[model samples]
Target: MSRRTAVIALTALAPVSWGSTYAVTTEFLPPDRPLFTGLMRALPAGLALLAITRTLPRGAWWWKSAALGALNIGAFFPLLFLAAYRLPGGVAAVVGSVGPLFVVALAALLLRERPTARALLAAIAAAFGVSLVVLKAGAALDLVGVLAGLASAVSMSAGTVLTKRWGRPEGVGPLVLTGWQLSAGGLLIAPVALLVEGAPPALDGRAIAGYAYLALANTAVAYWLWFRGIERLTATSVTLLGPLSPISAAVIGWAALGQALGPVQLAGMAIAFGATLAGQLPSRGTFSPAERNGQELSVDPRIPAVRR
Candidate 1:
């Protein structure tokens, strides 16, 4: 495969793995400990990456890494877990599906990329399709859960745009950047999890295996791919792939979790998947106006500064 296609496929794996989180949490992990689960998913994986990379942030990056971590991991995780616990079925997924719209607007404002009509429409269609796939006819929504879902979406959206805007420091690979954010975010979650949830719950073999999968596959590696993709692709394209999470969730629910998928859900999946594919199409040229004019745009990090 071409490099761009490979990046897209690898990045797409992040959300696809994330789609299994609900099932893993419900089936194997302890109950009513969203903070702890978030902690487990982030901290160990982060520390592992840090050890492997053996790189530390310098100067401004220390703060930048911390900020990005808070938005993407610390804040996003607990909120996401809260929504999953409180909101039944697809309500949380539907709420979170608005992320692309948030990214589109943020990119326009923060990244100075013009929003394309296709992106706007795809975001709407993806949300609607996800709602159909996951939202039950009368799934009662908790007010707190809805708010949490919205907040998580916003937090992650902001994190994504900021990641794209900042890019990585010279000589810092996505592995190092991923480690920094995960560690920072995990540390942030540690105190709150301790305060709110008290002690960590004892883990059985099932829970241990679940947490291990979450930390390694779902979080550490997945986030590395995600950040890597962000370095190459437009923020809009990256976030648009988020719909796959719910669609994957639904499929897993059917095949693994014994949840049924009716005709409507199938149609919804098709629509959402279609929008996801469409979102990957290039928006104008990848280069910004300044770059096209043979001028450097602000910071030129080690990563190729492609906006699309």
Candidate 2:
């Protein structure tokens, strides 16, 4: 595969791994410890990456990493777990599917890229498709859970756009970036978890195994791939992949858990998957004259180009 294609596939793995979170959390994790769960998922993974990479954020990156980590992980994780705890998994996933819309808007404001009509439409369709796939008849939604779900989406969307806008410094790899953010986020969560949750929940073999997977594979590997993708792909393109999380969750439910899929859900899957593929296509008529003439497209001067 071409470099770009390989990068895209690797990046896609992040969300696909994330799709398993709802199932894992509900089945294996201790109940009502969102803060502690978030801390465990983040800090260990971050520290591992830091050890592997042997790198630390310098100067301005210290604060920048902290802020980004707070938005993406510290704040986002607890809210996500709260939503997952209160709302049905499908409802929470459906709510989180609105992230692309937030990304589109944030990209315009943060990255100074004008939102395309096609992308906007795809975002809408993806949300609708996810709702069809996951929303069951008589699915009860808690008001706080719904708000938390939406807030999680918005928080991550803002982080995504900002990450794209503030690309990594020269010679810094995505692994280091991932490590920085994860560690920062973990530190942010530590005090909060201690204050709110008091003590860590007791873990059996199954729960320990689940947390291990989340820290190693889901947080470390996944976020590394995600940050790497953000460096290469447009923010909107990255966020468009959010729909796959719900779809993957639904498939896991069907195949592994024996949850039955209805005709409408199947159709919704097709539509959402198609929209994801479409969203990856480069926007037509977006290339500047230089790009049209076979030169590299110019990035916004405000946003630093990521060095490969």
Candidate 3:
């Protein structure tokens, strides 16, 4: 495969793996320990990546990594778990599907990339499709859960757009970038997990397996591919892939958990899947006046520069 194709496939794996998180958490993870679960998911995988890469952030990267880590993992994780716990899996998935819209807006404000009409439409269709597939009649929604779900999407969307805007530092690879963010996110979670959650829950063999999978395959490998893709793909394009997570989750629920899917759910899945494919199409026009005139959006200087 071409390098670009390979990168897209790899990046796609991140969300595909993430789609399984709902299942794994509900089945195998210790209950009532969202912060602890987030810590385990991030820190060990990050530390492992650091060991393999043998690279440490220098100068501005320390803080930059911390900030990105906080947005992408540290904050996103606990909130995600909270939503999952309070909301039904479908409700949470539907709420999280709005991430692409958030990314499109943030890209315009943060990266100076005007939102394309096609992308906006795809985002809307994807959200509608996900809602159809996941939202059930009479599903109760908790206010706290809804807020957490929305906050999680915003946090990750901001992180994604900022990642693309800054790019990576010269000579820094995605693995290292993934490591920095994961490590920083993990560290941030560590204190909270202790202070609020008290201690890690005892794990059975099944829970241990679940945690291992999350740390290695889901967080480490998946994030490496994600960062690698962001370096090459437009942030908006990459975020368009967000809908796939819910689709994957829905499929897993149907296939693995034997959750029955009606005709409407199936139709919804098809629409969401189509929207995701449509979102990947290349933008077909010249740069907007703002971009042509070097009016690129600038992030706060306090944010560390990314390697490009």
Per-candidate clashes come to 0, 0, 5
lDDT of 3 by residue, 54-171 (tens): 9999888888899899999999988887888889977888888899999999988877778988999999999999999998899999999999999999999988977876666667
Residue pairs whose backbone atoms clash in candidate 2: none
Please rank every candidate by TM-score, starting with the best: 1, 2, 3
- Model 3 misplaced regions, further than 4 Å: 1-3, 284-308
Candidate 2's residue-wise lDDT over 113-199, tens digit each? 689988998899899899989988899979999999999999899889878877776677789999999999999899989998898
Candidate 1 wrong stretches, greater than 4 Å: 287-308
TM-score of each: 0.92, 0.91, 0.89
| Winning model by TM-score | 1
- Which candidate model has the greater lDDT, 1 or 3? 1
| Candidate with better TM-score, 2 vs 3 | 2
Looking at model 3, the pairs that clash are: 168-306, 168-307, 168-308, 169-306, 169-307
Give me the candidate number with maximum lDDT.
Answer: 1
Q: How close is candidate 2 to the true structure, as a TM-score?
A: 0.91
Q: Least accurate stretch of 10 residues (summed lDDT) in model 2?
A: 297-306
lDDT of 1 at 78: 86
